[model samples]
Target chain A: MDPINFVILAAILFAIGSAAVLLRRNAIIAFMGVELMLNAANLSLVSFSRIHGEIDGQVMAFFVMVVAAAEVVVGLAIIIAVFRARQTISLDEPSELKG
Target chain B: MVNPLLFWIIAALTVIPSLSLLFARKAVHVAMAIVLVMVGLAAAYVALGAPFLGVVQIVVYTGAVMMLFLFVLMLVGVDQREDLKETIKGQRWIGLLAAGGLGAFLVSVVARVALPVQEETVGEPDVIAEVLFQRYVLVIEVLGFLLITAAVGALVLTHAPRLKPRRTQLEVQRDRVRVGANPVNKPMPGVYARHNALDVPALDPEGQPIEDSVSRVLKIRHQTQDGAEFRAQLEDPARKDTEEGR
Candidate 1:
C-alpha cells in the first residue's frame, strides 16, 4: 500500500475528531476529541517522515506527544475544577457567565 | 510502504471505532473507542518505518493519556450521561458536514499529489535518540519544564481549600445536646437472644422496637426484619411453656 494512505487515514480520523468536538456535549468526550485530533496529526507526521526518508518527522511527533500529555493533564484538572463548582461536565451548562 | 492488507486492517481498526466519539452516549464507551484508535495509529506508525514513534504512541496515549481521561471520567461520574439535546437547531448536521468536507478535501489533495515514498531508516530508539538529542535537545529541555508546570497546575486546580475548621466529636456532641437530640448512642440492632442480626431492631425501655437501631439503608431497602414479631412470641407465656417442654 502507498504510505500516503496513512495520511488519508489521519485526515479521516481528524475529521471524526472534529465532529466529536462539535457534536458531543460532555466536556470529557470533547476533550477526548482533541486527543484524537492530536493523534491524527502525529500519524500524518510519521507518515511524512517515512515519505521523506528522515528521522526529523519522528522527532517532531515525539515533541507533539509531550505537549499533548501536558495538555491532557491541565485540561483534565480544569474539568475536575469545573465539575466541582458546577456539578456538571456538560459544556453547555457552564456557558453562563456566573460560576 | 505498508502492506495493502495491513493498511486496510489498520484503517478498519481506526475508522470504525472513532465513530463512537460522535455517537456513543456514554463517555466511558467513547473513551474506550478512542483508545482503540490510538492503538491503530501506533500500528500505522510502526508499519511506516517509525517503530520508535509507534512505541511512544502506545506508551503515552494508551497508557498515560487515556488513563488520565478514565480517572477524570470516574472522578466526575462513571455513568454520567450527556445532554443530547442540541440547543442550536441543526448544529449537529452542520458540524458533520463541515468535518466531512474537510476530510474529503484533504484526501483528494493528498491522493492527487503523489509524494514519493522512500524508507531510508527504521526509527529504532538509538537512531531516534541521536536526532532527538542533537538537533532537538533544547526542545526536550523545554518539554521537561512544561511537564513539571502541568503537574503543579493540576494540583493547584483540583486542590480544595479548608473553608471551615473540622468539627470535632466533642463539639458535635455539644451541638446535638443543644439541639435537644438524643445525645446517647442508639441501641444496637438484634436485642433478642435467638435473633441477633443487623436487620433486627433493638427494643426500647417501653418494649417498643427501636426502629433507628437498624440501618436506614436496610430499612429503605426493606431488608430489615420486624423485631416486634419476635418480641410478641417471646412474651407469650403459653408459647414459652411449649418451647420449654420441647
Candidate 2:
C-alpha cells in the first residue's frame, strides 16, 4: 500500500472519530468513536511501518489492541454499573465524577 | 501507485460507517456502525500488509468487544427513547467550535504540509513474528499479563454480587397480592382466558370452574373484624339478574 494514501485516509478517520467523541453525549457511543480514533492511529502506525520497512509499528498495533480490549471490557462494565446506579449513561449525567 | 479503484472503494466503506455512527439516532445503530467501521479498518489493515493485525483486529475487536458493547446496549435497553438530554450547557456550540477549529487547523496544515514519499517492503507474518518474539519478548510477556489481568478483572467485575436491592415496597406488595389470591374462592382464568372459559389454569389461584358454565365465575369471601363472614360468587343467576337489571 502507498503510505501517503493510507496516511490521508487514516487522518480523515481520526478527525471524524475525534469529532464524534467530542460531540456525542452517550458514553458508549463516545467510547466507540474513541475506538475509531484508535483504529485510525493503528492504521497510521502500520502504514508508517510499511513505509520504513520495519515491524515496530505492527508490534505497537498489537499493544494498542491489547490496551483497547482491556479498556473496553473494564470500561464498559464500569459504565454499566454506573448507569444502573445513576439511571443514565450519558456523559453529562456523570459530571459529579469530574473532580 | 496504489490501485485508485480499490482505494476509493475501501475509503467509501470506512467512511460510510464512521459517519453512520455520528448520525444514527438509536444507540444500537450507533453500536452497529462502530462494528462496521472496525471491520472496514481491519480490511484496510490487511490491505496495508499487516495481515496478522488485520485478523486480530477483526477477531478481538469487531467480533468480541463490539458485541459486548451491543449486548450491554441491548441489556440496558438503550434505544432511541433512552437518549438522555445533553446535560452540559453550551456543549453543542463548544463541540462545534472545537471541531471547526480542528478542521480549520487540519486544512491549513494540509495546505502547507507535504508528506515525504517512501517505498514499502511488505513482510510475511512469520518474519514479523520472529522480530516480535525475539526482539520484543518482554513486551509480549507484559502484554500477556495485561490480557490476563483484563480477563480476570472483567470476569470479577461482571460477576461480583451486585448489591442485591431489597425488593421495593411496591414490588413486595404486588408479589404478596398475587400470592394471596386464595385457591378455593374461584378459578382464575388461564393466561389465555378467551381460549378456555372452563379450562382453568393448572396453576390457577382459585378452584376449578363447573363444567358447561358459559360465563366465568369468581368467588370472593371477605371476613369482617366482628367475625361476620359473607361470600360473593359469580353465578348464572347473579349474572343474569345483574345483566337484566342493567
Candidate 3:
C-alpha cells in the first residue's frame, strides 16, 4: 500500500478543520479547529517522512506539536479572559476587536 | 506500507467524530468527539511508523490539550447556549459553501500530484533523536523558551487586577454588626434534642421555631419539616387521645 493515501487523508482532515474554523461560532471550538488543522499538517509531515525514508519530517511534526501546545495555552487563556469580561464565549460576542 | 483495513478503520474513527465538530450542538459533546478524533489520529500516527509521535499525540492531545479545553468549557459555563442567530446575514450558508469549495480544491490538488512511494520507513526514536539533537537542537532550546513564555503569558493574560482593597476580618465583622447582623455565628439548622435533619429548624429559647436556622435552599424547595409540628406532638395531649390527629 502506498503511503500517499495518508497524505490524502491529511488533506481531507485539513479541509474539515478549515471548515470547522470557518463555520463554528464558539471560540474554543474554533481553537479546536486550529488544532485539527495542525494535526492534519503533522500527518502529512509524517506521511512524507515515510515516503522519503527520512526522520526529519517526524522531527518537524514534533516541533509542531510543541508549538501547538504552547499556542493552545495562550489562546485558551485569552478566551478565558474574554469570557470573564463578556460572560460569553461566542465568537460573535466580541465585535470590538473586529477588523 | 500501512494496511488498507487499518486506514479505513482510522478514517472512520477520525472522520465520523470530526463531523461532530460541525454538527454537535453541545460544546461538551463536541469536546468528547474531538477526544475520540485525537485518539484515532494517534492510531494513525502509530500505523504510519511514528510510534513516538503516536504516544506523544495521546499524552499531549487527549491527556493535556483536551483536558484544558474541557476545563475552559466548564469555566465558561456548560449550558452557555451558542448564540446561533446570524449577526451577519447568510453567514452560515456562505461558510458552508466556502468550505465545500475549499475541500473540493484541496482534493483536486492533492489527487493531481503524483509522488514516488518508497519502502516502509519506521521512525525509530534513535534516528529521530539524532536529527533532533544534532540538527534541531537550537529549535529545541527555542521551544523550551517559547513554552516558558507561553506559561507566563497565560498567567499575565488571565490575571485579574485587584479592583478594590481587600476587606480585613475586623472590617467585615464591623460591617456585619453595622448592618444589624448577628456578630456571632447564626444558629445552625436542626434541633439537637429532636430530629437532626437539616430541614428541621432549631428551637429558640422561647420554644419558637427559628426559621432562619434552616437552609434557605430547603425552604425554597418546600422540603422543610415543621419544627412546630414536632413540638406540638410533644405538647399535645389531644393528638395522643384523638385518632384524627397527626
Candidate 4:
C-alpha cells in the first residue's frame, strides 16, 4: 500500500481514538481509546518503517507491545484498587487527587 | 487500486467503532468497540507489510492486555450502577480552543513552509538496529528494567489479601467458649467466670468448679428450657439471705 494511504487512515484512527479518550467517562472505555491511539501510531510507524525498508520500526513496535501489555496490567490493577476503595469505576470520581 | 480501497474500508471500520466507544454508556460495549479498533489496526499493520508487528500487536495488546483489563473490570464488579461521570472540568472549551489554535497554526505554517524534502532513503532493517543497539543500548536496557519493575509492581498491587468472609460475633463467642473463655456479654478475665458461677455451674460437660466467684454476675437470668428462665441467686440465695437478714 502507498505510504500516503497508510498515513491518512492512521491519522483518522488516531483522531477518532483521541476523541473517544477525551469524551468518554468510563475508565475502561477510555483505556480502550488509549489503545486505539497507540495502535494508530503503531500502524503509521510500521508502515513508514516498511516504506524505508527498516527493521527498527518493527523492533520498536515490539517494544511498544511489551510496554502496552505492562501498562494494561498495572493500569487495570490500579483501576481495580481505586474502584475497590471508592466503590465506583467512574473516572470522574477519582478527581479527588487534584492538587 | 484494491489496496487503497481496502485501506479506506478498514479505516472506516476502525473509525466508526472507535467513535462508538465514546458514545456507549455501557462499559462492556465500549470494550467491544476497542477490540474492533485493535483488530482493525492489526489489519492495517498487515496491509503496511509489517505482518510480524501486526500479529504481536493483536496478541499482546488485544489478547493479553485488554483481556486483563476486562478481567479486572469483571472481577471488581464494575456494573451499570458505577455511575460514570466526566472527570474533566471545562474540557469542552479547552478542547475547542486547543483544536482551533492548532488548526490556525497549521494553516499559517502550511502557507509559509515548503513541503518537506525527502531524505536519502536508508537501507534495510539491520541498519536501523545497528544504529539502535550501537548508540541506544543504554536506553533499551533502561526500558527493559522499567518493564520488569512494572510487572512486579502490578503483582504486588493486585495480590491483596483475599476478601474472605469475616468471622461473625457468634463464631467469635463460640471460639472463646471452646477455648474455656468468654468473649462477649461479660467483663474482663475472671469476672465473667465468677458471674456465671451459680447459673452455669462454672463447668462444661465434665464436672469442675469455676473460680473467681462474684455476687453481681449471679443476677442474670439463665434459661433451662425454651421460654423458661431463672435467676442464678435462686440456687444459692438462701445461704446468703439467712446471714444478711440476721
DockQ (C-alpha based) per candidate is: 0.84, 0.53, 0.78, 0.33
**lDDT by residue for model 3 (A1-99), tens:** 677878788888888888888889999888888898899899999989888877888999999999999999999999999988989888988889877
Model 4 Cα lDDT, one tens digit per residue, A3-94: 55565566666666666666656677777777777777777677666666656666677677767777777888788777778877666777
Could you give me the TM-score of model 1 versus the true structure? 0.91
Candidate 1, after superposition: displacement of residue B7 in Å?
A: 1.3
Higher-ranked by TM-score: 2 or 3: 3
Summarize candidate 2's per-residue lDDT along B35-152 as a digit string, tens digits: 8878878877777778888889999988898899888888777752534455667776787677657756764564464556455555467877888899989988988888889888
Q: Is the docking of candidate 2 incorrect, acceptable, medium or high quality?
A: medium
Score residue B194 of candidate 1 by CA lDDT: 73
After superposition, candidate 4 runs with Cα above 4 Å error = B81-141, B161-246
Order of candidates by DockQ, top first?
Answer: 1, 3, 2, 4
Give each model a TM-score.
Answer: 0.91, 0.75, 0.91, 0.64
Order of all candidates by TM-score, from best down to worst?
1, 3, 2, 4
Which ten-residue region of model 1 chain B has the weakest summed lDDT? B187-196
Top model number, lDDT:
1
Clashes of each: 0, 0, 0, 1
Q: Per-residue lDDT for A1-99 in model 1, tens only?
A: 788888888999998888888888899999999999998999899888988999899999999999999999999999999999989999889767666
Question: CAPRI band of model 4?
Answer: acceptable
TM-score of 3: 0.91
